[model samples]
Target: MAQGENGSIHENTGERSPAGQEAAQDTSLAPRRRKPWFLLVALVLVAAIVVLIARKPKDTQSSATAGPQIATIKAATAHLGDIGYYVDALGTVTPVATVNLYSQVNGTVTDVHYTEGQMVHRGDPLIDIDPRPYEAQLEEAEGTLQHDRSVLAQAEMDLARYEKAVTLQAIAQQTYDDQKLAVEQYRGTVRNDIGQVQAAQVQLSYCHLTSPINGRIGLRLIDRGNTVFSGASNPLVIITQLQPVTVVFDVAEDNLGQVRDQILHRKALPVDAFDRSQETKLASGKLLTLDNQIDTSTGTVRFRAQFDNNDLTLYPNQFVNARLLVKTLKNAVLVPSAAVQRNGTQAFVYVVTGNTVKIQAVTELTTEGDVSAVTGIDAGTVVPVTGFDKLQSGSTVTIQSMQAFDSGQQRLERTQDKSGSTL
Candidate 1:
């Protein structure tokens, strides 16, 4: 050991005093302790900065994906063609003529000339009644007529003799006049008897029941051997004409002017009948006549259309839907009715171009089936029919399908069948 300045003791190597050595150790420890803490703090700051940087991109991506999505829709193109204007109405099929047959004389039904539901022509015998009593009455009238006629002849002969006697001055003028008056009275009696014979003949002919119209017979109300009377409430059978059947339909009174104009200008306007679904066409006919008065309660007018029901597609009292074609618009701008949307009273459509839609105003003239005759939009313009709810004035759109609308009824019917809806 050695002694140094300030009385500090040193080790055998003469290195330094205890105070200097402690000071050096303290300085080195300070640097080591500060280095670990500074490194830990720097690492924490770096982790925070890296986390912020990663989160910024995630947030930006979330915002970008959260924007409004494009809407998908179906569209159709407008067509330039003809569209028929028609008036629709509910109708009932009626027979051209209906007749109920009843016996005109009281007698037993001896024979039935035809089967039930058989077709018969006018004056065709339907039922044969026992005419024995009527024949007897006719014979008695004939006998009385013969007796009266003989008496008249005898009286005429006597009058002739009296007339000659008067001319010769062998008889008084008063007596001759009486003989002439007697002859006249006998002649009048003969005429009366002849009239009675004719009446009896008519009564005898009534014993045979015949059809008054050409038609199909209904169920027989009276059977053979059953008694029938002229004044009976029940008829023997009912006959209805099937061919050339008539359809009675009621049209809205507001459309009466158009229908009347067409009828006046074009005779026998075309009419069509359809089934309950209004898809199946049953028959075709022509406008026959209109009722004398309109039904005030329903604001409608009854019109009759006649059809040549050669195929018997129409039946008496059958219910059907009628459509009368009044006019046809040529070179009309037509579009699908589904594409038209009403904003209050104004009609509008979404015209799509380049994946974007623009609201367009259009004038709708008339709608028939799934088509609408419109004005404003030109033919060949694309119109969106679906996705209207997700759209605005300038919304983006993705067309799922684009179809061509036919002005003809073929495509219209096909669409109806697919959707099972009216439009």
Candidate 2:
């Protein structure tokens, strides 16, 4: 046992041992060593945090100084003009009249008078059936008629003689009565014979087929030398009137009121027909009529237009894009259709003032081809027609070309001034 100043015991090397003193000294030194390490680590962590915090503002400032962005766009100037607002619809060209000519008599086809696709006038003979049989029948009917008439005349003469003889009592009364009956019978026979003659003549006329209307004939369904019967299933030929054609189309029912007004006013609304691509004008016509009823399933109404196709520009069964000139709006603010943008139900246009753009709400009245009529913006206002994706309110824009806007405005003003002076 060793006694220490703190009155503790040590079992090893039993002298007043130095172990406790050394352990006490070590324990005091351990805290001093750990304090520097902890302070160094803490100082390093604090310095890193301070450095990160100090750099944040400079990074943000550097980003802020990168400069404002600008977008390039194409712009067009709105102009006042006479914009023809039209109702567009799909249509089909049809002939005014189509006639399928059929043989009306049982006879061999004797002649094809018209060529295929030949234009013919009314009463122009198109086909001829063998007339020999019909002619013979007519002759037979005429002979029977002549024979009955002669017998009737003879019986009437005999009846007159018998009546005179009965009065003189030179002949039996029965014979006179018989003679009167014979005369009446012969007259009835003669009337029947006359009917037969007329019927035969009608059949004979049918053997020679003529065009019922002025038209272009289609292909010959039956060739010459082919036997054609009355009421045959196939027609001898088809004739379609082509000089004046018609177009039938369907229009949205919503526009029915305006169309009916035009009709009631007796306004000859013009209808222009174009090819399927709607690029070329095929023909010009007048709106003929509107159907009696609307088609419930399609929400549309059918309309007919008549075209004087003197140049044969319209062909039957051809598909066309029809534009009915419902009305014309004068002094309308028209712009390129591309300039308009829609956000939900709101339509807007971006008008460029100097280098910046501002939003202008517009009501799109009508769109015709590449141009649109809009309200809420004045004519001659410059609006961007393209590159709208990069645009926002107050966005800076570099115009690729300003010539269109400038020139258009100038031209429009000059025209209006000239028109006003002329008026």
Candidate 3:
């Protein structure tokens, strides 16, 4: 029985050892069950890829969806009417009628009918000379004229009587002849007295000085108490007509033929006068006349333009810039001056094509204000105005709506306001 118990114990111990050994084997295999370095590395790489994908630049994919980055202008058809070829020149404003007021007779100035710088009409009395002496002279002239008239009547009657006496021989022939001679002498004397009287009367009428033309009187050189004389070198006052004024300017000889042709064809050429600043237009007028001949020394021609100065804004001797409209052109192509780009003396423009910009050479004809007349660029072509500094031929542009572009930002804001207002 003891031997049996020993065998049972050995079996039990062996069973326990097998179970423990199995547990030990399981524990050792647990360390060996860990994943390989390559598998871990693959899992880490997959995780890194996912994170990188999530952190990638979002704008890159949506960049193409962003609208064009260029500013554009819609080309419109325009009727180019009367494109004038103008000649620019300097000019001076002058009065159409200028006169120097003077006294016609020697006398003391008694009354001044007009104030300084006063507007006077034609035949208006401006200066009234002392009339007392003139009145006495007129009275004396009248009496002398009356006496001459009575003497002339008596001489005619005597001549008729002498002719009758000579024909009838009622008196001595010598006596009749002497009587006729006496009548002739009396007639000559009477005619002389009449002329003297008329002269005196004309001298009396010259006491009053009147305006020769309708004009504005300048400052009076002679006061009311001053003495003035007829045919004096200096005038009593100077007067100028400001209502109808004249502007005189010079044009080159080359343009003379054009001006003359325009005058003959159109009857009148249009002229515009601007002040010194060239910003303010003073008046518009028609070409009235030209000098008889061109100035040989300067190879230029002088011209005069007449303006109706109803407003009286133009003053005499004021300098001005003048433009003469010689002719006009029709169906002209014009673009903004800013759209033209210059490379040396060659002129070019940026034209918008399908997904690209092109640089095209153009011929510039003339410029008026901010617009230029050009050829080669059609009216429908889109010419760049603002981005010329950053643009080149064939450059891709993000075409932005001109209405939506902000010049300050040089960009277009895409977001609408919270109020749903389009910016």
Candidate 4:
């Protein structure tokens, strides 16, 4: 230690003055500045390592599932079952018997016996067309009939007397013959009078209108006090048989042979009718009959089905869709229709064996809804339905149900979204 001239403390150097001290100080500060930069570089490297560690599991999982190395797909199994073959066509609801009822007698409508939209039975009175006139006519006919009957009795008595007298020769032969002829003439006249009386009775009965069948009656055209005539242009009311109705539909010519064979064999083919949207079943019925000839314009044939519409689910002239079950492939190889893939002229399916898939060629026999009957594949064969775009023969796969696959995909997307937000 040395004392300065003004008694200030001073650090002793061996051979450097204040300028040399400043140079030494500068050299010592250089190492300190360089150490901070080295620490910064080390911190950057540590951050990079931490990030890699955090993302390691995610990368492993994503790599395992994201690519086509092991495709996740929806799958199903082929099994032995019965699949229906159906023919679908638009149909119309029709009533078995519809009648536009009109008055049969020329008279005023004195009383209406039925309300609009009424249910009627056979022989139920529907209207009274001035029955007072009918009563008079019936009375006249009865009187005439009684009088003719009396005349016929008298003629028969006279004929007996003429026969007896001719046999005994009590009168001239010519005179007896004339009497016999006159009696015969009177008997014939009586018979004709009786016929006329009956005709009048029938005409009188026509004044009272009655239902001829059991059915539902539509709107009434003739009201009380309205006059109506026989064979009028417009009907008084409409009646339709509803309890046992029918549906008529058209079937394509392609299916005519099978349907005709079934009909010939007297097999009752079932038919189901649906609404316009085909989302609801309206009625069920059996095949009634088919048209005798095909319609050349549409290459189709008409079919009629009968339904016991106890519930009245169908109406006349209403449109519907019909499904006819043609046949069933019993104990056949059945698979999901979605599993069948087409490549140009070839149909194939992805048959899953263990963790890999192999393309199996198949022939689709028929499809009903979501199920199909196919050939060239045995029962209980596992097959893949979805994730086919990235698949090929001998490709590895992870079997999953449609729900599971969708859930996994959702989770992966969520993970990716989280990662992006963090960045």
Best by lDDT: 1
Candidate 4, residue 339: CA error in Å? 1.6
- How far residue 274's Cα lies from its native spot in candidate 3, in Å, is 1.9
Q: Which stretches of candidate 4 lie above 4 Å from their native place?
A: 1-70, 344-346, 392-395, 402-423
Q: Higher TM-score: candidate 1 or 2?
A: 1
Q: lDDT tens string, model 1, 1-423?
A: 234643453343477768888998998898788889899999999999999999999999998989767999999999888877888999999998998777788999999988888999999998889999999999999999999999999988888998899999999999999888988999899999999999999999988878888889998778899998888989888999998899999999999998888778866688888899998878777899999899989999999999888788899999999988788888998899999999999999999989889989999988877889999999889999888999988889999998666784555456446644332
Candidate 4 lDDT, 354-376, residue by residue in tens: 88999999999877656777999
lDDT score, candidate 3, position 66: 81
Ranking by TM-score: 1, 2, 4, 3
Q: Estimate each model's TM-score.
A: 0.79, 0.75, 0.70, 0.75
lDDT of the candidates, in the order given: 0.87, 0.86, 0.75, 0.80
Off by over 4 Å in 2: 1-61, 151-189, 403-423
Q: Residues 1-423, candidate 2: write the lDDT tens digits.
A: 235633443444355458777987898998789899999999999999999999999999988998668999888889887666689999999898999888789989889899988999999988888899989999999999999899999999999999999999999999999999998899899999999999999999999999999989887687889998888898889999998999999999999998889889999998878899987677778999989998999999999999988788899999999989888777889888888899999999999999999999999988776778899999879999877889999999999975342222343345446433210
Residue-level lDDT for 94 in candidate 2: 88
Candidate 3 lDDT over 230-282, as tens digits, reads 88999888989998999999999998987888777867887877889876677
Which regions in candidate 1 have their CA more than 4 angstroms from the true location? 1-67, 409-423
Best by TM-score: 1
Error of 2 at 235 (Å): 1.6
Q: What is the lDDT of residue 339 in candidate 4?
A: 91
Model 4 / residue 280 / CA error / Å: 2.1
Worst 10 residues of 3 by lDDT: 406-415
